[model samples]
Target: MLVGDGARLAEAAGDLQELGLGPMGTTQLAYLDPPYNRGGSFNGYDDNMPRHEWLAYIEERLVAARELLAETGTIWVHLDDAEAHRVRCLLDEVFGVEAFIADLTVESNPKGRQLDRFFAGSHDRLMVYARNPDKVVLDGGIAAAVNPADFPHVDSDGVNFRLLPLRNTNKRFNPMTTPTMTYPLYGDPETGAVAVDPGPGKVEILPVFGDLTPAVWRWSRDRAVERVDELVCRTVRGRSGTRIDIYQRDRHEVGRIKKLKTIWLSQEVGSTDTARAELRAAGVDGFRTPKPEALMRRIIELSTVPDDLVVDLFAGSGTTAVAARDLGRRWVVVERNPDTVRDVILPRLGLTGS
Candidate 1:
């Protein structure tokens, strides 16, 4: 649940823990995108803290965040270049090196700027850590090609070019992650084509699609068979050669193609424009420097899944709450100022405390 408090974070942590959050019962993710100690005024909330002060502030809040996180949950702290390293040192002490997932540099501004002192500071850092290193889920995979040319040979009516499987010749044991990813290799003596068991006993010739990493076959047996059938349906023998229908890669399915990266771009995540649009739709708008709904949405997507409870202490314009609701996740935003929560924030969300 979201709660805004005027007191120190340590105090709030105790209060939240007693409210039944710990271990396996409730999956709690304590996400704090606090002021970057950049001396910016967040609606009169002074964020400019001295170096030592920033470190101390992080220590207190990090302690509280750790206490509030569920055993299997995680904590994602966002910061700028100014104090990312300092914050990492404190995080390393608290969350440990093994738990550290990434030190992402997010591009805050895409358009390059004219500067003489240094390169345009287009990025920020997001320190991600799992409460329990053993169970944290990570999304990883290559970016899918959107153009049909990327796939090349269309196999079916809507299918893109299919990759012929390469025989698994060199197999290595990776104990850290997927153990079942190991297999054997096979090849055709005459055609010089490699035979691979994409999954189970399914065998197919390796495509001449240039060099591919071992075990990176185009598709598994079931998938390949489906593709073959599809290809046949759309296949037409022309005077030149066999022709195949091509289809554009579906954008929505990109998330499922592979694992997700720690570094997210403004395009991948919701942008300030999208956030403003959502707020506009909800009839909530005010606080300057409000987090773009896209930014909050990306955070929510990672830490908390649908139906999970999310809490944001510095509720500000309530972008977190709005994004959480839109994603089907329940959220609570705490703002000590009653007017911000009651009049400005809650009204926009259509929620009331009475």
Candidate 2:
């Protein structure tokens, strides 16, 4: 559902709630990118509201957004240093301290904003909260960025991968705890081939600690056999001389998707400079502080799945809408600034031209 220019956020959010897009919650994610009250005026919005007034404005919108969420729904409030702390406290009051999830620090400007008085500012905050913490669904994780240094070894297929020890080093996991994982692996150190059964010239390797204490393997026998190609034998020179150990190839692509961290600086999550470049490339101008679509897509993917409803109360350049569309999520973007809606958001969303 698309709201035209002059549509107020609170009203639109209430209307969306009434629509009942889903039985659980009308929306899965309320992506709020409101004005930061940073003492500036852009094409169609004012950012110079007094502290008390700004807090009130945010409170009203957040209340409306809360009503639109389902039991498992969450909200991501985007803010800058100018009001992030204040808004976080306000969020605790509005959404309850128990509902608070996590705060994401996005490196929106790696170069840092030089206009800052004390120190150069580089990042922004995304404060997340759930309607019901017990029911909130957050199984999804973000993709980690790749670093060439981490993948120093190349495989036979010319794939870059890193070697991870097949042994489970944690003291809590060992032969006493998991006897099934305490089996021996047959390996030909010279040929770098690993097998479950020992053949002629095959060396038996047992999972053990530095003290030779029994330890468990990271994978089960069935799993290791199924993905045997991913296993390899690496020779290392230690103080005790050369020894062979079994390692699993953490291929570049296979190891990239990791748990989402608080600090986000991946190239895919573009910075302010890249976001501005994308706006310029799209021929959409006038709106200040437009977020890159990649950042929005990441937030969407983190909080909601495909077909879930995503609402952006402050639709600057319609980045949220475009991102949600690309990710196969339902979205509704609202902006009160008619000129910005006409000149930037609509054009960026291909709804109209500047």
The candidate that achieves the highest lDDT relative to the unseen native structure: 2
State the lDDT of candidate 2 residue by residue for 1-354, as single tens digits: 574443454454445534433333568898888888988887566789999988988988788778778788999999998899999998898889999999889998898879989899999998999988999987447554446688898877887989899999797999888899988898988888889888987898988765566788999999998998888886767665566689998987653565677898847689877778888899876656778878988888878989998887788778898899889998877777777777777776678643
lDDT of candidate 1 over 148-208, digit per residue (tens)? 4545554336545544232233334232233344333333333233333343433333222
**TM per prediction:** 0.68, 0.73
lDDT of each: 0.58, 0.81
TM-score of 1: 0.68
Q: Number of the top candidate by TM-score? A: 2
Candidate 2 stretches with Cα past 4 Å from truth are 4-14, 18-24, 96-99, 132-162, 168-236, 240-246, 249-256, 352-354
**Model 1 ranges with Cα > 4 A deviation:** 6-8, 17-25, 112-118, 140-161, 164-255, 270-288
Which pairs clash in model 2?
25-70
